[model samples]
Target: MNCHQAYEALQGLIDNSLNKKELVEIKTHVRNCPACKAEYRALKMVAEGLDRMPLYETSPGFNKEVFRRLGLEYKPQRRPAWQSLAMAAGLSLSVFWLTALAAALPTLLMGAKAYKLTQWLHHPELILPSFQSAILKSGLAAYQTLGFAAKVAGWLLKSSALPTQMAVAGLLALVLVFITMRFFRPQTSL
Candidate 1:
């Protein structure tokens, strides 16, 4: 193994996680390479120092006290049953009033404009010109813009090299998506 490979394997060697074959290769490389040997010594010393440090113990209720200091404790509130019932009753009354108003709407409108409503209903053509002209103008404008866009897209699709270009673009997009997914993937242990 080279110095680079030995350095990469140094952590595994220090943690005693390397298999026999890799262990031998890394040990030989580290012994032969002065830089790698020094790096290994420094890492080993740090690991040993960490292992030698004393572990501290916390007193009972320590977590609860910490959470209390941080103001994260949950306090439950109890509300009276009558308050809930009153809210429900208010909501039901409001819904009933709305429904009754909706049911009486046609009758109210008929009383206000019975002649004009009847004329429009009998002769539907009378309603068309007032509403249709504005809608047709807007629809024509939209159709013109959409038609221009469709023509441009059709021209691009008709080009002889478009298939090759699309294939290359698709491959690039797939590669970018794969790289993004790998970069943002959550780390989990087996």
Candidate 2:
């Protein structure tokens, strides 16, 4: 019924889809209002211009080209069976050799050290007061290390049992409550 309503209904009017009552109201308003009449004419011109523009057509084989690039119908290429088997065998051999070398290294070093210790004990010239002092210090270190390890182990054992005990007790309580509710609770009629 005003310039504002005519502007809002301009698109619907140009599209020829406005209801009868709305069309009548718009027409009456446009007839009396110059601003609304101009706005309606502008909207109609814009719609007509859009309709007159040329539409573009898509090229043929566009979808097939897209699917081909995406590998939709293509089978995956697999590595040769012998190559896979060789890789697995090489990995296994490397792992086995690594583990065997690790196992042998400590024994070999210990044997070499034992041979040097035996030769030093046999030679009175090489045995000195500093060697005795070093041995004493190493023994003291071992005792201290053992004491610290025992303390850590005792603390871990006490804490580990507590958490498991509490967890089991809580789980048992939950199970008991669930069973009591399932068997003893009354059913309510809907």
Candidate 3:
């Protein structure tokens, strides 16, 4: 809002480039300050005059002509394909690091108490966890897969006739039984 700042923003005000807050502050300053007001009026009039000037069409070779006069060839810069991908990946990693830093800042500055607060980070359920059964759960998950299979076998024997379950088991266990009986026959002989 100072005279210097007002002068600096005068061109921006004419060009419509200053942001809302800055535009308001500079406009207010210009309204109050006589010198800034005169400067603004001068710049605004020049800008308006330039805007009113007629546009002229140039030949297609104008750019080449200009470059020729300057003794240079006009080759536009070409960006590498990986440049944009690397920039995007860098930005994503930066955001992740910034977020991680924000989260760990509290723990880094001051000690966090109550192990319960950070317990979830430690007890990472890699595959599964047991369900506490107040539950109407029918399915068993893989927390103890082999144990559940044994439980299912015991249930089949108790609930159904032995021969029926045994027949199915016998067919399914063909490869498994062969592997076990053949592989361990030596140890059993001893």
- The candidate that achieves the highest TM-score relative to the unseen native structure: 2
Candidate 2 pairs with clashing backbones: none
Q: For all the candidates, what are their Cα RMSDs to the real structure?
A: 21.7, 29.5, 29.2
Write the number of the candidate with greater TM-score, choosing between 1 and 3.
1
Which pairs clash (backbone N, Cα, C closer than 3 Å) in model 1? none
- Reference-based TM-score of each model: 0.32, 0.34, 0.30
Q: Order the candidates by TM-score, highest first.
A: 2, 1, 3
Question: What is the C-alpha lDDT profile of model 3 across 1-190, one tens digit per residue?
Answer: 7998888899999999999999999989988899999999999999999987665556657788889999998875566777666555555444433333333334434544532364443334433353422110211122123234434665766744433433344343453444444432332111
lDDT of 2 by residue, 1-190 (tens): 7676678887778888899999998888888889988888888888889987665545555676777999877444578898677666655444433333333333245754643554433333355577775654444444334334434545755653423433343343454445444443344332
Q: 2 or 3: which has the higher TM-score? A: 2
User: Among all windows of ten consecutive residues in candidate 1, which has the lowest summed lDDT?
Assistant: 96-105
Off by over 4 Å in 2: 70-190
- Residues 33-119 of candidate 1 have per-residue lDDT tens digits of 899999999999999999876545566567777788999984545567876665565554444333333332443446536434543
Each candidate: what lDDT?
A: 0.59, 0.57, 0.57
- lDDT score, candidate 2, position 162: 29
- Badly placed stretches (over 4 Å) of model 1 are 60-190
Candidate 1 TM-score, true structure as reference: 0.32
Ranking by lDDT: 1, 2, 3
